[model samples]
Target: MLKALRCNSLERCFQRVTSLAEARQALAEPQTILWLDLFNPSQEELQDVGAAFHLHPLAVEDASHKHQRPKIEEYDSFYLLVFYTVQAEPSPERLRVCELSIFLGERYLITVHSEPIPELEETEQRWTRNVRQLEGGVIVLLYSLLDTIVDQYFPVLDAMVEQAEALEDRLFSGELRQRSFTQDLLALKKRFLTLRRIAGPERDVLNVLTNRDNPLFNEHALLYFRDVYDHIMRVADTVDLYRDQLSSTMDANLSIVSNDLNKTMRTLTAASIVLVVDALLAGIWGMNFEYMPELHWTYGYALALTVMAVISLLLLLIFRRLR
Candidate 1:
């Protein structure tokens, strides 16, 4: 879907532009700014918007493709930025990330995404609430979008922290008998890895937006971008920290499992030893000897049984003390 919001100094409020023709006309208005948003657009829609805006082929291609790295590229008349919006999926093991491609021109900003980004919606509402400050230029609007995206990471990180804590608790509580425990732990690690991959480059992207000599970004906008850069840095650091913690947690869990297995083996060995002693006594008594003392004397059979029971009890006590 395609949507457009047009803002101008004279208008004092955002005006809806319904069609590409209207957007093009609005672009000609003095001191005007335009935002075009496309969500889950088809190939034809992308081509139409790309052609209408005379967007660079590479930028348009990047928008069509999924899994583009987070970065910003300077085109002739605009900048193409690729970033991701992340949310934890219903399954705690997986992260849901949506790639958003933005074309930031002097007077317009066009955003394309295959999936819905709640940040964009929230940014729009924010702009509506603070139009006096954000509506002055597209740069400010872009700042708001970036700010929203960066802020969204914290909640996901918080959820991951809670999940990691829960897993750690479960690990210590002897729930390792569950078959899926290790798999879940590994999945959480993967999610953190993915978060790092996304946030690290995003920090660089923000760095470029703040430090690059781009005419589109004014001093005020650069400051806002710097603030966002700082936020992304924190996110990257958090990812790294959690990844290490999870690794340690996994190692501890492995050690616990090994210790438990060793205890089981020791128990089995003790049982085997007691049974072997009883078998040895029975074997000696069962020997075929016509002159054997146990066969000749009536009390000999009772004495052999008593000896076996006493040896077995001694072995059991020794093993119990050793354990």
Candidate 2:
């Protein structure tokens, strides 16, 4: 899908351009700010756009591929930026990451992504409501897009924090078993690591945009990028803290499981000792020998039974006291 937003002197227009030819025509207009957004464009479409804008072949290739790390690369005529948009799945244990590639030029901006980003749609809505805000040229639009993407990280981080807290509560209350809770903690740990992998590099990307000298961004526009840099730093710090907390939680869970197992083994050992005493007495009495005089006595059977019962009771009392 291809969507375009054009802002001219008279009015602002937003439409979906169906063919590559239409997108090229929109870009041809003079003194207009055009935003072309392509969702999962084919190689042919990418090459056509690259040819039209004189974009470097290497940058076009990078845009066509996935799994690119977040960074900013400066070219002779434009800047190629890669950023990740994050979303938490219905299951809090997992996170979904989507790569958004942006080409920022003096008069035009192009965004390419395989997955749908709600942040882009929201930014378009904001642009429609007030076109004047984006009149500052492509830099303003670039800032708006980056700001929206950075803001999205907070809600995902918040959800993960809530999940960690809930798991901690269950751990202490003994509502979750060791095996089940350990699996959950492991899942949370993995998600946190994934988040850090994205956020850490992206923060550095923003830091470069803020500190480095780039002709694409003016003094006023650099300020906005710095603000975004601060937000990314906060997100990075929070992720680090959560990782430490998760490690501690896992260690505590393992300790609890070990302690429970030890108690069970102790109880089983005490029970086995009591049974062994009874078995020993039975073995002695059952031995058949003609020289055994007690076998002929009248009260011999009752006396033997009484003796066994007394010994068993005494052993039971001793075991209980030791426990």
The model with the greatest lDDT is 1
lDDT of 2 by residue, 197-219 (tens): 99899998998888877676778
Cα deviation at 95, candidate 1, in Å, is 2.6
Root-mean-square deviation of each candidate, in angstroms?
Answer: 2.0, 2.7
| TM-scores, each model vs. reference | 0.92, 0.88
Best by TM-score: 1
Model 1 segments beyond 4 Å from truth?
A: 134-136, 173-177, 289-293
Structural RMSD, model 1: 2.0
Model 1 per-residue lDDT at 229: 91
Q: Residues 105-215, candidate 1, lDDT per residue (tens digit)?
A: 888999999887889989888876776775458887888888998899999999998888888899888565465888889988999999999999998899888888766
C-alpha lDDT of candidate 2 relative to the true structure = 0.85
